[model samples]
Target: MSAVPQERRLVTAIPGPKSQELQARRTATVAGGVGSVLPVFTTRAGGGIVEDVDGNRLIDFGSGIAVTSVGASAEAVVRRASAQLQDFTHTCFMVTPYEGYVEVCEQLAELTPGDHAKKSALFNSGAEAVENAVKIARAYTRRQAVVVFDHGYHGRTNLTMALTAKNMPYKHGFGPFAPEIYRVPVAYGYRWPTGAENAGAEASAQAIDMINKQIGAENVAAIIIEPVLGEGGFIEPAKGFLPAISQFATDNGIVFVADEIQSGFCRTGQWFACEDEGVVPDLITTAKGIAGGLPLAAVTGRAEIMDAPHAGGLGGTYGGNPVACAAALGAIETMKELDLNGKAKRIEEVMKGRLAAMAEKHDVIGDIRGRGAMIAVELVESGTRDGAKTPDAAAAAALAKACHQEGLLVLTCGTYGNVLRFLPPLVIGEDLLNEGLDIIENAFAGI
Candidate 1:
């Protein structure tokens, strides 16, 4: 039913001639700061394949950084979005509200974790949602300091940059960030000084101690974290870590916020990563996969917390645009009709099975982590294993290049830039999934 052929075929080299020309033009016109993972100019995409201008079809493992969980061109999404465009594109929800906006909020309330009375406010991007979440938390608690964890990435805005841990590309020179933001250690299993088994208890204790000693818990407004660290190597917090921190926030009267931008929807096995540990957050920020490929984000949580801010205090000219809201409803419909959650679980089984075998053969793969369709391999120096390995960033970069050359699109992330993450569409075919893994294995062999 898809127009694009769901197969990997190379008519020419990776970036073929047309893509090369486009890259040259992009270099001259686009901002130097705007970077790309792959240079191929896509002409069409659907299912598991991205077809470039030169007619080469590459197996897409990134899914536009986990945005297109229902496939880039899902039928329901196209139908709803096209219908919305035909009727009306924009009335600006704030100026003249439409049912689409309220419908999306209602769906988010039902879909996101918790059965309690909940509310939501849509935004244009993850950064905007995160900023607004902080605002609502501050207003509700009447506190200042916000707590974040090491290796956590919230967004690119000033307040988010202060919350982010990585410095090089994210925070390098982007200062002075917003104030009253505090950073503490997360239970990073592979890198924790203590063993992975002990990381949860030890790290949580340390974080609580620092918050109490340095910034009084009474002064903290929110404690935010990614249930599964996205750009931070797909690190799922060690067991008990999330529950402990969440309990601390509850005991201290601080709002517990879950930054589920990259890990929400069916990207993880569950609708939300926090559901894995049954850790219910007071506030949860969602984006990336909310609207198929459209730009939509939201902060959904307790009704009281979401309504803390005055009515006029929370709105944007383009937030919850009618067209985007329509697309979101379509996406949710597709997710339910197709049972994307089960598909994500299937992807996890296939990926972990193959990756675990590869790890047995290659010591560079120090750890294979993540859940469901969102997975990753942390590359480290050769001959190292367990918790004794050193990050090998060069290896990660080289391996990614190899995968690119072979028409298998992959991506790398992490504070050290040594992690190769995979986020294939939940609709990806099982054969294509294995083929992509084969390419990765071959790349490691070549390395």
Candidate 2:
């Protein structure tokens, strides 16, 4: 049904001549700090493939960093968005509320992890949603300190930069970050100081102790975390970690927020990753996969908490543009009609199976964890026989580069830069998925 061919095809080299020219032009105009994973310039994309200007079709695995769960050119999303565009493009929701915006909020209420009366406010990016969620929590709790975890990534804004843990590209030289933000260790199963079996209880106890003794739980506004760490590598916390932390927040009257920006909207085999452990949050921030590649984000939460901020105090000029809202509605339709959550589960099954096989053959893959299409493989020094497990960032970089050259797009992430994260579109064909895995297998064999 899609115009773009679903199969990967190579008429020329991966970054063909046209892409090289475009890259040169991009370098000249675009900011140097804005990095790219693959150099090819896409002419069209749909289903499992991104067709470049050079007529080469590359299998897409990144999903524009987990934004295109329904595929880039989803039928319903395009139709609804284009219809909204023809009627009128930008009547800011704050200026004049639209039905599309209200409808999107309604969907968020129904789909996100709870049955409680929920309310939502839309935004233009994940960072804005997170920032606003923090503002609302602070307003509700009347507290100052906010707690985050090691390797957690919130955003690029001043406050969020402080919430984030990585320093190199995210926080480097962007100092004098906001105060009252605290960091604690997460129950990282693979890297836990104690064994994985003890991670859930030990890390929770340590974090709770630090909050009480140091920050004082009474003074904390919110304890926000990604149910599954995204930019921090796809590290899902140990089995009981989320429930323990959520209980702590509830006991202390501190708001518990789930930064589900990258792990929500069917990317994690469920509407939200937090549902996996049944650990509902007081607030949840979402984006990335909500609107079929369009820029949209939301902060959805308990009605009482969401209402804490005086309404006029919580809106941006372009917060919920009508067109983006329409796209979101259409995206939600596609997700339900096709059962993208099930598709995500299937992706996880296939990916984990293949990755496990790869791990058996290649010792570099230290760990493979993540739910659904939001999967990652952490690379370690090849002969970590003693299990020092030193991160092999260079190998990850080389592997990604090799995949790129072979017309398969892959992304590397993690605090240590040693994670190969795969976020294939949920609508991707199983054949394309297996082909992409074959490419990864071949690439690893070469490595």
- Kindly list the per-residue Cα lDDT of model 2 for residues 396-442, writing each as its tens digit: 99999999988899999999999999999999999999999999999
Residue 118's lDDT within candidate 2 is 99
- Tell me, what's the RMSD of every candidate? 0.8, 0.9
Give lDDT for model 2.
0.93
* Regions of model 1 farther than 4 Å from truth: none
lDDT by residue (tens digit), candidate 1, 1-447: 468888899999988999999999999999999899999999999999999999999999999999999999989889999999999999888888899999999999998888889999999999899999999999999999999999999889999989999997989988999999999999999888878899999999999999999999999999999999998889999999999999999999999999999999999989999999999999999999999999999999999999999878998999998888889998999899989999999999999999999998999999999999999999999987665688999999999999999999999999999999999999999999999999999999999
Q: Rate the local accuracy (lDDT) of all candidates.
A: 0.94, 0.93
| Residue pairs in candidate 1 whose N, alpha carbon or C atoms collide under 3 angstroms | none
Residue 296's C-alpha lDDT in candidate 2? 92
Worst 10-residue stretch by lDDT in candidate 1? 382-391
